[model samples]
Target: MLVSLIFKRTYRPNVNTIQWNKTIQNHQSNGNYQQALKLFQLGIEKNTFQPNSVTYLTILDICKELKSLPTVRKIHHLIDESKNLNNDDIQNNPRIRSLLMDVYIKCQDIDSAYKIFQSMNERNLIDYCAIMTGFNHQKQYEKTFELSKQIPASIKYSSPVLCTLILQACIELNKYDDGYKIHQYGKKFLPNNKIFMNELLNFYLKFHQEKQALDIFDKYQNQQTIIDYSLLMKYYNRQYQPDKTIELCYRLKNHSHIQIDHIIYVLVLQAIANGCCLHTSEQIYNQIKKSQTHMDINNALINMYGKLGNLDQAEKIFNSMSKHNIVSYNILLNLYGLYYQSDKALKTYHQMCQHGHQPDDKTYVLLLHTLSQTPNKINDVKRIFSTIEEHKRGPMVTAAMIAALIRAQLFDEVNDLLKKLPKENILFYAMKANSNETNEKFHYPISITNEQLALYDLLMSNIYTYAGLHDRLTNVDEILYENKILKDRLSYSWFERSNGKIEYFKSEQLQLKTCEHTEKLALINALDEQKNSSSPILIGKNHRTCTECHDYFKKVSLSSSQKKVYLRDSTRFHIFSNGTCSCEISS
Candidate 1:
């Protein structure tokens, strides 16, 4: 009777098997994928019972979830050893192969995925798409192209994913002609599919076909994805159309189906900041405050306020932050340096150190620049230059330091530093500094310094002699006034302008009998050329403008129908209009 009962029973899973399967299912359902995999590994190691096909399938799912190649390989080995499991089973079930292929591809094991793909007897559209995607992911462009060409026309045309992959390949290779042809062929598949449509739009943008790009965007902007909006904002920002960028930002904000993200806000903030529209910037700031609190948003606001020249507001934002990063301090340090607030810049640097932020190369560079402007901070400049040399910074910092020294009129130190500088043209001939030294060797090498130095010498001599002065009221002016004859003979006779034409007016042209100022010569030439138009004439004087040119511009402004004259003298900018100069009261 017992034998009869045993013979009557069918092969059913025992209690252990039922418990193991339930545990895996429970963990997987709960999204505890790693625990699911670990329990499966433990069940196999126990060898309590033989795993059925369903068990192997569950293991494959876990491997795919983990995207682990080693575990997939272990499962593949176990399946090969099992008598019940074989390639025939895999061949019969394409899903197992697809799962394995997905795991391999996700692990960036393109070769293994390709082998699995090729082993399939009857390949489908998905298999072809998966392999092509693998190649694309690996940036194996040639392999992708070769595989794409081999796909059947019928299969390729029906699969939008395949078509999109081919388009991406063409885009990556910068094959504009081929991409355009393929895009026109696949236009029918792009209506409802945002992924492929964006690829098509990207192709047009890559080739700089703005009209075509905009046309494509307008056709599909209603159905575009978040990525599509981001790309469009980037394009507009690149084109310097801040208004369009902000418009798109507002549009994205109002989209019912789309959720605005922090990344989009960061990009839009850059656009509005550059527009200098502080009103729009304030609105965005309020939005960011409501929904987001990130270091990036804070940094962008700091940059925007700095650009608008509101350092107090920038500092307020900086102080409001509970946390600070290197970039945050960098922004404030650069702001102080840009405005030439040496004390504030130095204080910011010390504060950054106190906050445990290590200074980078840019920090040191900004400090060097600030120190250069503060002539009284010469000792700090020396210390910073030492740090720069210790870190083996490049020639730019060294060059800047040398230039700072020269501007400070520390010519002896400049000569010593120039010898240490690398053999660049600007640094090479900087050893020569004295203008009164008669030795040709001590003079700047004309070949390397080029004609700019020649022009500089001519301008300097003009100011040194005060050749345009109406009266020698001061004794120092009297001695220089007496030395004009030899200086005038040695100075430049003519100079050139941007029009490729030379204006030849010797010192004889000066209303002053002794000499003509170089800046006066250039101004007279510029005004005479553009006498008919009532536009401001810009003149750059390398040295301080002589009293004669100052008086001349005032007279020119009043007499020439209010023709403004802007003079950028050595120290500051002076605007002359209607017989009045900006520096009139200060002088």
Candidate 2:
């Protein structure tokens, strides 16, 4: 009878433990982590079963998913106590230790994770990866680099995951030399590993080592994923090489093995918009419309069409959306503003408000800009400005309001607003310089540091030119030249051909001195191309259209036998036809 009782006492616990582990694993596999955690807690409280390493590991995983730091610590303590109860020494088990480290990292307790790593009897690759990744996740890049140096020399080549993390650390530390060395090591030891290769490409790109980045990209072009292409295109776009961005888009489209995801589609559309390739934009749009729609893609299309001066297409896309987000409404409002349709913009704003989509800062700014263009809408501008929350009225909003009052010839009101602005405000100085009625001498504040002085000078020069104060403009220009702050903002334009080729022309490339301005050169090219094509001329300008170029475009439209010109400048689209432009005509 004694033997039978003892056997049952020992045997029943093992059976219960097996059942509990199976049940917990089943719940975890089904993604019922919370239920699994409850079962673990019940088992611990009931004390009916002894939890083996499997049970501890499973529960730890559950804690990780829940990000329950308390539960993890409890489990860790129980595991420690289990050394006496069940003879399960965690010191001998690397798996439990690694899992504990992972849980600690997931719970954002890197200190505890590192302690576990330090207590490990045998520090394998997995152990190193866990703690190093934790350090990286915590943004302890210096610690990550320090740990990498401690890696055992016996381990021949670093794992791809480890190498990637190290490269990321190098990037954060701005250790370009170390990153280059890793790239060389990866090429030799981790050859053809796409994960490591991609990291290598990113490291080079982040440092603006474009030549080396392109080398990797060209070599691994066949193996490049959508992410790699996206990164390259983004890098080129940031570098202001929109032409190269478009080229990459074409290459990505032609790659047979690659699938064009929504992200890539949005990026391609952005490049097309930046390059002002109307034909390419249409082709891409046709492809997009046939696929499953994404809101981002639709937003990009709306923005692209708006830039292309195709308002009808933009509106059509906006109306087709079953759901509207704040971005969608803002883009529509901006479109109306771009075409100088103040009434339509106001209507859209009302519709947006009715839809319960609150206007953001961008929406308010666009509304102010649109309303300020029409003389009759000054009251509407005032009403909208009054409704804006106090915190939202920053320099940009106040500047827009000031410009509106100036346009309305409300000089006294403008002066009042200007006085309220702090002297350190660059926009305040710009507005003061722009107003013809104000003869206030420009005062440079002591707080305006050297870095801001260049921007201030440039802003004043633009204001002087816009106000037709040529003497003031020339004076600012000399200041800019003396300080070596004036840069030749060379003008350029691009247009798409029927064959999907984008032809680019720079102001310096024009043979005739009269065609030195970007818009004139673009018009000359467009008229020459008009003989063979019936499509409207769409030119993308690199800078805002000056008044001289605006007048030139108007005169050209009057005499060009009804040739429509769509010039997308830095500020907005200027669609010229029949001697009329989409922009509000200045008095």
Candidate 3:
């Protein structure tokens, strides 16, 4: 009798909604969000007879999945029209409010989400917790605290969602004191919500507050699902606590709901790779294949072999993939480039493009970087640059190309490259975030000269040294410390180098000032004069080369600034001030 009823929950009497739900689930699982959304709407319109919050939440789920604000508002209105929200079974509609709030949060419509929270005047702690979770989702930590104040004291603070929000926000902002206070508050409501307890443990472990983190882990770690264990183990691997990571995985093996995922398996493999235990990672990967889950663990294998510098094994594993993804190509391209195998890198690029996979920004950046390593390969950089377009460029690519141009001392070309960019400088952008600096854009082409091509190689070497790219930094540093002239040229263009070294140009000489008799008269018609005096910054196509005067500016610049200041040869005017710069390059 129980078995019959257990099966009945999934049996939809309305055959249309059932079929649509299956399609919706399939589309969602594949991350084809738009298809999922349309199918949900069709189901709702065609079968309003089976309307419930589950049906509405299905619509909301599609909104969250698609991240479509306009559709989400329309779905909310549909729910209002259905008035199933007025049903006595509000208790069964566990996720309707939460999912709606989630959609609003994803849309960044925080005000709309808050308004919904305001209308829920019955003020169940779950509702309060959901609102706090919504605020946290929006990364509005201050708002999370502000709303927490409104909850009545009769309601407990350790509501599953509130504790989780506080834990997440504290870590995000690095506010240890606030984390501690909420953590202390959390133990009271710990009897229910095992998920919250695991979250707290994860936060503690994140801060390396291990004593408390593990103690909590020991008390309720068994209560967690596979996700918590995998997360805990991943954190442990990061913290170099391999023993604990293994222990958690072992404990998780018994939980019926927990099973191996590619990510967790990858984490364990990483620990093996780090400890020089390639055999162990391989053993784990082999075991993972037997779990009845379809996952390509080839990337993990490649990464392991990569660490050992065993290109043969890495390549063997890469070739074994039935269908290669962008990540697989990127990893191999990087390895070949790392060895300065320029011919190999170019060939790989051809293979990738031939396979109908357009190379992302990193692919182009990697090629340019390898080209920067050798003078012979300089043409490759020029060819690649000419293939790019401004709109497709990103900060990392722009910065890399800018440094490359500067290294070639194509002083006049910097303006063209920069005008294509959105920022005043790439350094300012890198400061705001890590590797959000995507160079995946494959557009933004530019023409490059032989001199500019040579410069790309030199600048990339400097960048590699600074980033400590290889097994040793000296491969780059030796080149840097040796090239004092290059260093000086770079410095004059910017501020003082970090090393605070200065060197005067060898060709430094004074020049005789020649004044045109009509110079003052020209200024009287200054706007007209300005048209003729537009800087050398124009693209080469716009102006013919003035070969006779090319060498004359250095002398003029030296005499004008009492040094080799930018005004003489520089394109953009730099008005130098006390010991610093304003648009500090050159005029």
Candidate 4:
């Protein structure tokens, strides 16, 4: 009797169209989308009730949620069949067609979505948004721009959604001029809208217009979010304004409403690392330890300690981590390389392999770098270079190998390797080597930027001066002047004092009087600022310290002041005291 009752309930008939639609709507409202879809299909198959426009719309909504492309297509076919019977007309129902386009886009069938969009005789704002957003998501930035041109001017200026989409396209296409105009439009029209305001902030940040970004941030203080603060902090860090980054972090920390997260902590740590303030870094580290524990934060801590020349602390953090990933191992390997610990780096590489982590291209490059530091490890460098797959040897890997060979004074092998590389790669190598011979011999098909040409000229001049080729150096200087590239890419250095004040000096600023190198100017300024303090002065440079600068630092270490100095360059740290440098081989 129970089985019979269940069968009767399952096969109950006489359900009208209104009852079927209500049941589907009920299931949909309750978030039972699959059940809603099944009921609709059962109602259609059983012919208990005729499916109406409402039923079709609800089913399409379900398909959109499920991302069910096959089911959507089947329903579209049924709609077409119904049109033939004059029951439902798709042409008259733009709402249904727009929904259909949205479903197709959500299903990842952009071609079908575009077809439906094209079939719309009178497209609304919704239609344009659905299609353009789809194009943008698919990375068809050009198509998005083309559609923007067709947007009716009446709605184009008023729709925040359209403005945001166009701004995103402008960013991807690098259309700075258009992006600026859009920023002005957003300011004039949609100033108070949070969505558009956030996008505008992003636009300014992308173009590196810090003043403009700050203006927007200030104007939208009430609407500001953690993401905005994070983005601004990241921008400052990228621009090497670590002090500004830390200052902003302090502001965010003091905000009474918003709470800091792990990402913000990582950015704060990164800023401290760049600033090279061991005290501030330690303070932040202690605060982080008391509050939370995250892998990214720990990794960033390791990097911070590494930059401050505290390898033992970096190692302690690494040992404390319960799990390790490729990034963790890479950071440790990089730290070892930075300190020229080739043996330890090699042991760590073996351990990484044993733990089933395959070494990537960066691993091989780091290994080569560490091995190149010691003259006796030339053979190890060659062995490691051979193990790297040919396809994986990109421009950076090849350049690293060439650098290693040059450091070992293997000029013949360097020349042979240069011969085997493609012309483009050879040009890249020439730029790094600053070889005038290579520049004059090969005519590359690619056109390098003016900035790159200026850098090439500067490095070549340096090479000429080092070799005592006065005539060649003079000729390069003439070219540099003719190109008006003076001081465009000149190096600068800065140091933080004990009282947390930062002193910056540019190489160009001191060219007229006392110092020619950035590090020298920075050192003089640091000594003047911290005359009473005998602690080691840590200075960070934007470029590598030349041999002249290195020797000068060594001499300064033995002078009357007897000041110990730590100068961090593009690659590693150089600690000078008592007329000795930490680097085994001077540049």
Candidate 5:
């Protein structure tokens, strides 16, 4: 019972360099970065063991994980002083160079990363991917695309992630053709890659290929993250389908699979603004306020309120913000214009300038619109018009200028101005784009009369209708039918109520009854089609309202208890009531 058995214990305190390195690797792998660093320092201090390639690689990983430039510099210094790095095997490793570049990039030292990348003798796929990623992070989109092209010919194609980065560059630069080609070239790699798919969706959306964007989203909705949903929502917003954006938000919420973020909330707020759904906007606002908010949300609230004609609320939001950027000022300025508060708009413009916010083309356009509405500011309008021309504003501004000139009834001056306008100006393009002639290279000075301007206004105002009709006119039978319809409708006719049914007259009937102008006949037909409303009837015409129709609408309005009729001829707006037209423009 008292037998004692002796067991030998293996107690060895000495550890070799390989054993220490293994321990450090295990520590780093187990997420004990501090312990790993401690062990590494102890080994170097002891001087009995030297750091090896494994030790250096692990240190690089630690530097990248920490994203600390100071720690990276220390590790790089050690690498420079270490004699173990003199080994051919350790000195010639391409992976080491690539990892160094990645670490520098992660720490925001892009120049250092580029230097390391350039110093490498034999660049590999990893090196190219890392540098391109750095360029993308820095937002050097053109450089990113350019670098992608210089990948070694030996590497026939880049990886999916690299290709996605290149496509993103293309998206930022709006290189549609190049993007499409890359999409085709990389089709084999796109099936399961979310990043690639997102950039592709962006490309399609920007080019107005909504159907294509929808198809891609539908194909990948199950695999989509929150970012994907936001992309799709933004696409819908661009297309003016706010209802669809709201529907998508609901769909995302109902699934409850993805966690919502502030960015998504901002986009949803924009959608609500577009929809003018006050109730939904309030609900979303409450939700965002519960969490941290972003500046974009505040800006979007201002935009939504402004769009809904809630100027007071928009102003309150704008005033409450701690800081305001150019966009905030622009939105406020635009809202003032929308509400026809020209004085306030000019004040806001001055405020914007005072705050060092340079006005953009859109700003000038909004100012021009307000000035066009206020005829008393003709002198100010002229100065602003000249400034806009000096700035070389687009076709829209040119159109607005034409409208203002015609509104002021300066027909002779308008003709002279049109004659003097440069051949390459937007005014020329607007004239050519709206012309009925089929010549591609048609020169401008394209007829400078009131009727010409009226034709321009009508074509511009009814752009969608004109486009549809243009397409339909390619068929001979359709053209004949449309002409017949136009011919039979009377210029002064109204729809008659018969047996609880609306009876519409044809152009031929109109021609037989009275020789009213075609434009007036269309208005009559429209007013007659909606006979129950007491509000003003608004109509647009390609030419001046003939005296006959002008007299007719005035008489009708007077007899019908002073109901108003608003008409826009190419020259000016005519509001006829009580046998009087507001314009007083006698043809």
Candidate 6:
């Protein structure tokens, strides 16, 4: 009857008439925030302002909805105008006090919540619980713990709620011991309470207390949630203990029905991807498609396809999506770029943008590396409003840009980029710090520190021994090695880790090597002349020359024979004849 009175579209003089408040409370308790707000507003429009009571709270309800400070303050104005809000009422009434705190919290008015918390004349466990929850939400971690401590031992705190807070704080502080104790309290509610038990198990798992977590799981074996199965897998995955994680997944399924969520599948896929067996992961993708309950499965499919290098299948899956989200598009774009399908990569990028996904740094870097290779797009940096150096901030991306700059022969620009980097930014420097003490000579060869000599020596040696000068190569390494001036160089004991040969650096090769200095110089001259020529090229093995020979093949793009040419020798082949060959944009 009271609820009907509070709920019905009628007015009651005594606003405290439990009926009046009950109607509004019922809707709110059921999670109908919008309906509750409207009902509360309707009450305000109908009822004359009541002093110190439920009416102010109903107004607070609407304020909580808007979650805006200005509106909440206006409500506070109405709260103040009411003759009802007195020191006496706030002191005596628990409901009114709780409502005030909640409203301030919803408004994000922390100061007001604290102010009201201070004024509460009577406080109970529930009141304390409310404020503590409020503090946790506001991210006042220290205060949340401080208040938690103040709750008397006699009053049992909600184990689940307090556990959640302690779990978060412990994770942040890396204080797993205190976090362990909090897990003990969780079992108090675990016997008949499966929900609490699951949460407790999850807490243990999260804090690296896997033993306790597994114990909880085993204890509740008859009644395991999907979470138990998923977490067991994830826990092992995090520890990098893949075998055990996979073992747990199989164990749970053998005993009971384990429904795998998308997240768990993703973790499993990741676990498999990092390991050597891409083929095994392909099986999982097939299984997911065969499942009848697979409501949403595209994320896993894309990952599986990308890792397996099945571009055709991956693209089909991607293009067929009702909505190709950023993650999907990025994967497709990057996959195409990696496989050297530059045209398809640009198409995917355009498709992604048309779908409203703007390319981020990674996307631009992938395309830029490809674009940097061509004369048609030599000015990729200026086109993108970002410099190669600035965009190459990440080591991997910077590596691609480094290769591009070397290929373009932009030495000064390359040097400036290197100059901007700190000593640690250089890769070998980091390795050197952790290396054993050694004579610097083993690292650079010359005591005075010549970049060109050190690099040239390294490149020439590498080509001679391993990749070979004729290995359809780019001279980025050779050029870097040849730079004579270096600002900071490290003494790496591991420089000898690369067992390149001495034949290239051996002055004796000047005579017997496949191509002489004059041959290279002639090619360079030809290349120089053609650099200014807007000519097409077609060259082949017949017309191909050594790096020394092709130095003049700049118009070799205009090589009339085969579309491209490589200068071959006893080792490997250099890919250009007259500075013009097929593999130009980026290696």
**Selected candidate, larger TM-score, 2 vs 6:** 2
| lDDT ranking from best candidate downward | 2, 4, 1, 5, 3, 6
Off by over 4 Å in 3: 1-110, 119-122, 138-142, 156-158, 189-192, 219-221, 236-259, 274-296, 356-361, 385-392, 402-587
Report RMSD (Å) for each prediction in the order shown. Answer: 14.1, 6.9, 19.7, 6.4, 13.4, 14.9
Name the Cα RMSD for model 2: 6.9
Model 2 agreement with the true structure over 1-587: per-residue lDDT tens digits: 22222223322245788899999999999999999988877766555676787888888888888998887887887666555444544436789989998999999999999998888878888778788888988899999888888887454146777778889999999999988877766676433677787788789998989999888888766688887888888877655566677778778879999988898888888788777777777777788878899999999889888878789989998989898899998888877766788888999999999999988767887788777777899999999999987666776567667767766778688777776666657667655554566755565442333224423433443444446652333322232233221222324667876667777766443222222466677777777876677678888775445667778888887887456788876556787877878665531
lDDT of 3 by residue, 1-587 (tens): 22222222332345455556666778877888788776665544444334455556666777776788888887776554444334533323546766677678778898898887776546676667666776776678887766656767567463667667767777776778878887787777664677777778778876878888767766764465565666677777654444456555555666776676777666665554433342244456567768643224676667656543456888898877777777777777766654455677788788888888887877776677655555566667777877877678765566556665544555467557666656433232322222345533222122222222223333444444346442222222223223443322222211111121111222121221221112122112222322343221100010111222222333333433442222211111222223333222211
lDDT string, candidate 6, 231-267, tens digits: 6777676544444554554465476466666666666
* Superposed Cα deviation of residue 16, candidate 3 (Å): 23
lDDT of 3: 0.53
- lDDT per prediction? 0.65, 0.73, 0.53, 0.73, 0.63, 0.50
Which number leads on TM-score?
A: 4
TM-score of each: 0.58, 0.78, 0.54, 0.81, 0.53, 0.59
- Model 4: weakest 10-residue lDDT segment is 2-11
Error of 3 at 543 (Å): 45
Poorest 10 consecutive residues of model 6 by lDDT? 490-499
lDDT measured at residue 579 in model 1 versus the true structure, 0 to 100: 89
Tell me model 6's lDDT, rounded to 2 decimals: 0.50
Which residue runs does candidate 2 get wrong by more than 4 Å? 1-19, 50-52, 76-88, 91-93, 108-123, 131-157, 189-191, 358-361, 375-466, 470-490, 497-499, 507-516, 585-587
Tally clashes: model 5: 11
